[model samples]
Target chain A: MTSATKTLELLSFFSEQHPEIGLSQFCKLTSRDKATTYRHLQSLEIVGFIEKNPLTKKYRMGPAVLPLAQIRERTVPRKSAAKASVEQLADATGETAHVSVLSGTTLYSLVAVESPKHSTRAIVDLKTLPLHATASGICTLAYGPDILTQTAKQNLERFTAKTQTTEQGLDAAIQRVKETGFSHSKGSIEEDIYGLSAPLFDQSGTIAGAVSVASVATRFNADAERTIKHQLILASRQISHNWGGSIPNPIEACWSKTLAET
Target chain B: MTSATKTLELLSFFSEQHPEIGLSQFCKLTSRDKATTYRHLQSLEIVGFIEKNPLTKKYRMGPAVLPLAQIRERTVPRKSAAKASVEQLADATGETAHVSVLSGTTLYSLVAVESPKHSTRAIVDLKTLPLHATASGICTLAYGPDILTQTAKQNLERFTAKTQTTEQGLDAAIQRVKETGFSHSKGSIEEDIYGLSAPLFDQSGTIAGAVSVASVATRFNADAERTIKHQLILASRQISHNWGGSIPNPIEACWSKTLAET
Candidate 1:
């Protein structure tokens, strides 16, 4: 890997749970020499990508990311457009709803909203969803660019007993998603989470993302699944339209046939 | 500069007006050699910081920034905490209200809300506020760390006739802000916009940002100034408290005395 990529990789270590990282922690996280990691941290600090906390002397994300994100939002505008639909989907299903955008072989969780109706609800916290283990990821593999399947084949980290760990198993899941016009996963990533997702499109007339509903496994019944699927379709259509794309005719036909049968 | 900083600097070229930049365009923008620029662009693209548009082949920001910004928001919690207070400030004052955070000598505009009450509202569009020319910058100079004043003196870019271009002129403005516990700028950045700002604080027991109101120059009368100042104080206090900081006793005293006299 290039030095620049190595430097950039350090930023990915931060998350909501571990927002701050010290020099020693960075050495342990990257497993690189302490001096090299420190130099990378200094370079990042110089550009305002990271800042040292005054009290702890640990590094946290700086303000520079905000403007870059703002530029990305203005350029793509997927998150803003998908927000209302996702919120409505969450409210209608009483489940956690999220949108995942496909960018350069990565399925990124663009935004997630949780319903207040349930005392305990599923939360989509992963920054990047694994293709073989997520409903959104499986939906993308079924509908998005074909290369994602190859990418998924390379790294099928097993998260739970139900997570597909082999190419054959993953293909089975993808085939099911293609047949149903919706992606469904039960206890895939988490033991008690049931996920349902529908593909979203953008102005490029390609699969741009997926809008999904994640529910507690105990609450997943036929009626709830039906409602969630209906709401997911509504959300996908709304988000796709907002993103300046329409549902492809084949997907629309599949949804019609599947819903008719159900 | 290191290759990493150069690679990151390329991201700053993107803005609302110029969201995409081709390789040659980037070379022109940065005044760098084609090979170096292309290498930097490649590094950025590899990490998904920038992605080439499929049809145009021009580079725009990618999805990686969204997750980084999410981490920053979760870590600092500044934008969400200050958003409501800024909205209330705009509503009460009938002007454009914004919050700018100080980071490494740069005052980054965090968020801005424009009141629909005015047809000709001052729009806070710049990602970074010029230290010598904006109300937020001056407030930071007066009440923030001492190093900011030196940074302001180094780059006194004159935006309009009223902008402080000289060290003496900037010191005079800083003096007034220190006395009144508010910063004011008349036609400094734009021809007919008046700005008033008060400092905000974070949990570190130091000035973290500024909450400012930008109003139409013609409508900025004594009553409007008084009202804006009062609302700005309220906003600053609320935002500071939400950020886990409070107004310093001296600044609070200054505001109370200034308002009582007025």
Candidate 2:
């Protein structure tokens, strides 16, 4: 990797749980020499990508991300457009609802909302959903560009026993998503979590992302699944319209047929 | 500059007006060689900092910023904590209200809210507020670290005739802010915008940011300025408490004395 990429990669190590990282901690996280990691941190710090806490002397995300995010939202606006729909989906389904956007071949989680009704619920925590192992990923592969299928097939890392690890397994999953206009994953990324997602579209009239509902597997009965699927379809439609697109006629027809059968 | 800083600098060129740029456009914008710019763009694209529009082939800020913004909000939470207070300030002052955070020697605009009451209200558009020409920047220099004063002195670019372009002028302005626990700038950054700001604090018991009201100069009478100052003090206290800080005893005493005189 280029030094630039390595510097950018260090930013990915930060999250809600681990917001601050010291120089030595960065050394351990990236498995790079201390000098190299410190240099990378310095580069990021100079550009305002990261800042050191005055007390702890640990690095956390800096203010520069805010303007970039503002520009991104003003340009694309997918996250803000999907927010209300995802929140409504979570409220309606009493589960966790999230939206993921497709950039290149990767599925990046845009936003997630967990319902307050349940004590135990699924949390959508992954920054990038693995294409072969998550419902949103499978939905994207089924509906997005053909290049994504090749990308997914190349990195079919097995996460759980239910994760699709082979080309054939992933193809079957994609086919199911294509046929039903929805994707389902049972214990794919984690045990006792069930994910249901429907494809969202943008102004290009092509798949742009997915709106999903994740529920506790133990409570995911047929009625719950039916409710979640219905909510997912509503969320996808609303989000697509907000993004200046609509569910394609074929996907709408598929969803209608699948809902009737369910 | 290192290759990494050069690569990250490309992101700054993107704004609300120029959201997307082609490789040629980037080269022109940065005044760098086309090949070097292309390599920098490639490194950025690899890490999802920028993505090409499928049709336009121009690059814009990508999904990676959303996650980093999320982490920053989760860690520092200054924006969310200050949002309500700024909104209230705008409502009370009938002007544009904004919050700016101090990162190193720079004052970064965290969030801004415009009151719909006026059709020709001031708009806080810039990402970084200049220390010599902005109320927030002057407030930070008056109350934040001494390093900021030196930094502001080094680069006092004049934005308007009223801008403080000399060390003595800036020092005089900062002295007034330090005395009153408030900062005021009249047509400093822009021709007809009047800015009033009060300092905000974080848990570190130091000035973290400032909350300000930007008013159209024509409508900024004595009554309006007094109302804005009163509202700013309220906002500063509320936001400081939300950020796990309080107005220091001396600043509180200064505000009380200043308001009593007003």
lDDT tens string, model 2, A1-262?
8999999999999877898899999999899999999999999988878988766899988766766776776787777657878989999999999999999988999999999999999988899999888899999999988888998888888888877798988888999998999999999999889999999886456788899998899999999988998888889987886664668889999999999997
Task: Identify the runs in model 2 with alpha carbons over 4 angstroms from their true place.
Answer: A79-262, B79-262
lDDT per residue for candidate 2 within B1-262, as digits (tens), equals 9999999999989877898899999898899999999999999988778877766889988756766775776687777667878899999888999999999887899999999998998988899999889999999999978888998899989899888899999899999998999999999999999999999986556789899999999998989988999999999988886664668899989998998997
Compute the interface RMSD for each candidate structure.
7.3, 7.4
Query: Which sections of candidate 1 miss by over 4 Å?
Result: A79-262, B79-262
Q: Write the per-residue lDDT of candidate 1 for residues A1-262, one digit (tens) a residue.
A: 7778889999989877899999999999999999999888888988778977766899998767766776677777777668878999999999999999999899999999999998999988899999889999999999877788998899989899988898888888999888889999899999999999999986456788899999999989999989999999999987886664668888998898888887
**DockQ, 0 to 1 scale, candidate 1:** 0.21
Residue A107 shift from truth in candidate 2, angstroms: 21
lDDT (0 to 1) per candidate: 0.88, 0.87
In candidate 2 the C-alpha lDDT for residue A184 amounts to 95
Alpha-carbon TM-score of each model against the true structure: 0.41, 0.41
Q: All models, DockQ values? A: 0.21, 0.22
* Candidate 2: Cα lDDT at B93: 86
